[model samples]
Target: MIPLDEARARILAGLAPTGPETVPLAAGWNRVLARPIAARLTQPPADVSAMDGYALRAADAVEGATLRLAGASPAGKPYAGTLGAGEAVRIFTGGFVPAGADSILLQEDATAAEGHVRVNETVMLGRHIRRRGLDFAEGAELLGAGRRLTARDIGLAAAGNHPWLTVHRRPRIGILATGDEIALPGEKLPEGGIVSSNAHALAALVASCGGEASILPIAPDDPAEIAALASSGGFDLLVTTGGASVGEHDLVQKALGRDGFVLDFWQIAMRPGKPLIWGKLGAVPVLGLPGNPVSALVCAVVFLLPALAKLQGLADTATPTLRALAGVDLPANDKRADHLRATLTPGEGGVWIATPAARQDSSMLAVLAGADALVLRAPFAPKLAKGEPVEVIALAALGV
Candidate 1:
């Protein structure tokens, strides 16, 4: 058995970043950038007015100065001629500043007749004017690579005059659930049959991390059948729920071994999920998760999701852990690292207290759903009193 960090490193070491593709600006949201995006054109190509007011020479905009309204400049239309001494132009918001106009005497600070205007207040030079390239200059790097474009990023890219962008393709994942006794949800259950939900849960987790997930049909206990189905999925990554352990009915290893695959690691020393398997079959990476619902989701959050992020060119894949106070006196852990389901609430002095669930059965989905975080207990950790500091991983990151 290997440690959690070793398992994570092994998984990442065997994977490669996905290829890049060109997409339209409308489809670039939430996609990772393949290369740095540079501005195609300077913002505010020319000097423009920011407010609806009179545009005139700053030297002639002093108090009590009267000027003739030579012409008008509305948005998208510019005055054909330049300004002269004691001359002003009726410029609206976003209108291009007429040539030779040094500043704008605000409408609120001036009194205007039919063709003449009188300045009531002193005006400063270059006031209320948005200069050329005020926001971004041409050829400037607007956004760097490896950034996941958000709605705001899309708008910013559009402002840079980009109609399309280059981004990494979303990873495609194929999920398989193996067992004859398991049936999908909303189906009639046979005697002693159970509902199959691990595939659905795994799909949701994969999709939330920006991967394309497809749940395949269930496979029985036959090794040949499992191998055939697993080998033909054609996905970037293959994930199986059961038959990963060495039990009699464990056929996932038999079908995925020998001919065209290289096994990276098989198991790890951890609670809830220990019978995990990872390797490469041809060019596709295979991740074998446990059948237990909570264990499957836990392992997905810790391992599988990180792999997806790495493939997507994400900078960091570390799971977030927070410090909290224990609500009860917990005993020492064994050789296997433990992840206990618990609820976190505010305690005295603004510290959060975590209370572990009484029953941590891997099959209990209700308890897992109610849990806010998984308090991490290192292997062979000593006993702890109530109010002791403990590390916790939030379950909300799993999108449960």
Candidate 2:
């Protein structure tokens, strides 16, 4: 079996980002940018007031001084006439500073009477004024390519005068769950059969990572059935759960071979997910995962999430992890890397304590669902006692 990192690298190397499409700014949230967004016009346009105050010449405004009230400058409407000496303009927040005004006397610090205003405090030059282009300059890059648009990013793009944005098309994923003993939820099951959960779980994962997922009909143990469904192209990537291992019913590789499927590598040095498969069928990349629920989801987190990120034109494709302390004594690991489902608790000094579930059997979907994190145990890692530091992937943070 190959190492997990090598398998992930090979899968990513075989895939490219989806093509770009234009969408309205309102629809840009969570979409990866295909091009940089530049500022269309200078922000503020000109020197403006940052507070509700009176715009006046700093030299003429002094403590206990009175000035003639010229005109009011509201947000959208500007005072056309310039301010003369001993004259002040009534300006509100976001109002352009009238010509010949160098400072602002806050309304709270001034008293207004008939046709005049009294300054109780001395006004400083250039105070309470926001200069032109304070937020951004025209043609300045506000956001770069490969960035996923957040609510803040959407606001920034709108403020930059962009009504539409160019983003990579959402990667379309075809999910296939194949097994003779598994039936759909709420269906009459054969004796000792189980309900299929991998397809729905994987589809949710794909959507969470910005990919569109279509769950294909389940295929039984027959190679012909598997091949027929897999070759129905139009997917950026085809994900198959089950039939990846070397068992008699594991016919994914064999079935695809009839349709010119090119095998890249199969199996990885990882616990609960050693029977992973990475290959290609014609133009669509194929990733075959173990049928076990825990194995399917864990491998999806390890490999499929990064693959989706790459396909969406994201700049960073690596899985994010956090540091935590072991809550129990861990035994020595062997050749396979381990991903122990664990619960996270707050420890002293702001450190997190990760305690693995007692039953790590891959069939226990409940244990995997209740887990807060997956503590990573590298191959050949030495035994670690309680309180030892380790790296972990926080499942909730990844929206798994």
Candidate 3:
């Protein structure tokens, strides 16, 4: 067994980013940008009025000066007339500033009667005017590479005249479950048989991580069945739950190697999920998980999510970690790092506290139902008292 950090580093190093592809802007939300998006046009293409008011030469609009209204200028349509001394154009918001106009006096600040307008207050030059390129200039780098395309990013890209964007393709994951003791849900369970819940859960995890999950049907304990599936090489990553330990039914390691997988690490120094297998099948990465439901899920949170993020060229690919206060005292454990089940609640003063559930047995699925986070207790951790600070992994951050 190796340290958790060292195991994580090795796992991350083995994965490589899949190439990029062009996707329609509408469907590109949460996709990482593969190329820089440059602005096609300047914001406020021309000097325009910022409000409904009069556009005139500020020098001519002295205190108490009266000016004749040249014409009306609304948005989209420009008033094609020039403003002369003591003359103003009736301009609405977003209308083009008429030629020879250097200022805009707001309608509320001026009085209009007939075709003339009176200015009682002084107006400064260029006031209430949106100069060309005020927001962004043409050819400016609007978005950088590797930036996640969000709704606001999409809006900004559209404003920059980008109809489609180059983004990383979603990683494809192949899920395989191996064991004769496991059966799919809704099926009749024989004596001592359990449902194969890990594959479905892993598939959902892949989808939440912005990847496609291709779940192969349950592979029985037979080596031939497992080897055939591994040899197919139909996915970017292969995730197999069960058959990773050294028990009699464990065949994932041998079958994967028979089908051409180069092994990385077989186990990590972590509790409830010590029998993790990381390797590669053909060119695709493979992760062998424990048979227990909670153990598989915990491993997925620590390992699979980051693997997916890395495949998509994301920089911050690890699970979301936060500093949270411990609500109760915690005893230390030797040898293995523990991810204790906990519920995180927001308390007063904007702080989050984690309360570890008393029942932490890996087979207890009921405890995980109400869990919102996993309190990460490092290996050889000292006994902790209440109100002690600790690191926690949020469930939402794990894409659960």
Candidate 4:
């Protein structure tokens, strides 16, 4: 069996980002940018007031000084006339500062009566004014390519006069669950048959990682059925759960091989998901995961998440992990790398304490669901006592 890192590298190397598509600015949030968003126009296009105040010449805004009220300048409405000596213009936030005005006297600092205003505080030059292009200049790069746009980025893009944005098309994934013993939820079950959960669970994982998922019909154990269903193309990547092992019933590799599927690798040195499959069926890639519910989801977190990120043109595809203290003593690991499902709790000094569940059966979905993180134990790792440091992958942080 190949090491997990090599397996992951091979899977990512076989994929390329989806092509770019133009989308409305409102729909750009959470989508990876295909092209950099350059400012179409400067922000605060001209000198504007940053606060509600009176725009006037600094030389005439001294304490106890009275100046004639010139005109009013509200947001989106600028005073046409310039301020003269001993003159002030009533200006509100976002209002353009008229020519010949170099300072702002806050309204609270000045009292206006009839046609004259008295300054209670001395005004400083260039104070409380948002200068032209203060936020961003025309032609400046506001958002870079490969970035996942956020709400703040949308606002900035709007302020930069962008009505549309170019982003990568969401990756399309086809999920296939194979087995005769498993049936869809709520379907009539044969004796000893179980409800299928891997397809929908993996579909949710794909969606959380920004990929579009399509659940294909369940393929029975027959090689012909698996081959026929897998050959019905129109997907960027195909994910199959179950039927990956060497058991007589596990026929994913055998079935796909009939359709000229080139095998990259099939096994990895990892617990609960050793019978993993990664290969190419003609132009489409296929990732066959283990049948066990826990193993399927864990493998998805390890392999599928990065594949989705790469397909979306994201700059970083590495799975993010956090450091936590072991809440219980851990046993030494063997050759296979282990992902121990554990619960996390806040500890002293902002540290997290992770305690592995007593039973970690790969088929038990309840224990996996109650887990907050997966404590990573490298192959041949030595035993550790409580309070020792450990690296953990936070599940909720990944939106799984």
Worst 10 residues of 4 by lDDT: 183-192
TM-score of 2: 0.99
Per-residue lDDT over 280-335 for candidate 1, one digit per residue giving the tens place of the 0 to 100 score:
88888999998888888888878897888888877776777899999899999998
lDDT of 1 at 339: 91
Those runs of model 4 whose alpha carbons end farther than 4 Å from true positions after fitting are none
Cand. 1 Cα-lDDT: 0.89
TM-score of each: 0.90, 0.99, 0.94, 0.98
Q: List per-prediction Cα lDDT, in the order shown.
A: 0.89, 0.96, 0.88, 0.95
How far in Å is the alpha carbon of 99 misplaced in model 3? 2.8
Q: Number of clashes in every candidate structure?
A: 0, 0, 0, 0
Q: Tell me the lDDT of candidate 4.
A: 0.95
Rank by lDDT, descending? 2, 4, 1, 3
Tens-digit lDDT string for candidate 3 (1-400): 9888888888899988878899888988989888999999999899999999999999977779999988988999999877788899999999999999999999999999999999988899889999999989999999998777789999999999998999888888989998888788999875798888889988998888789998887898888899888666767788999999998889998887777778888889998899999988878888898988899999989888888888888878767789999999999878899999999988778789999998999988878767999999988999999888999988976668
lDDT at position 311, candidate 4: 93
Superior by lDDT: candidate 1 or candidate 2: 2
Better lDDT candidate (2, 3): 2
* Pairs with steric clashes in candidate 4: none
N/CA/C clash count, model 1: 0
Winner of 3 and 4 under lDDT: 4
Error of 3 at 214 (Å): 1.0
Off by over 4 Å in 2: none
Distance from true location, Cα of 235 in model 3, Å: 1.0
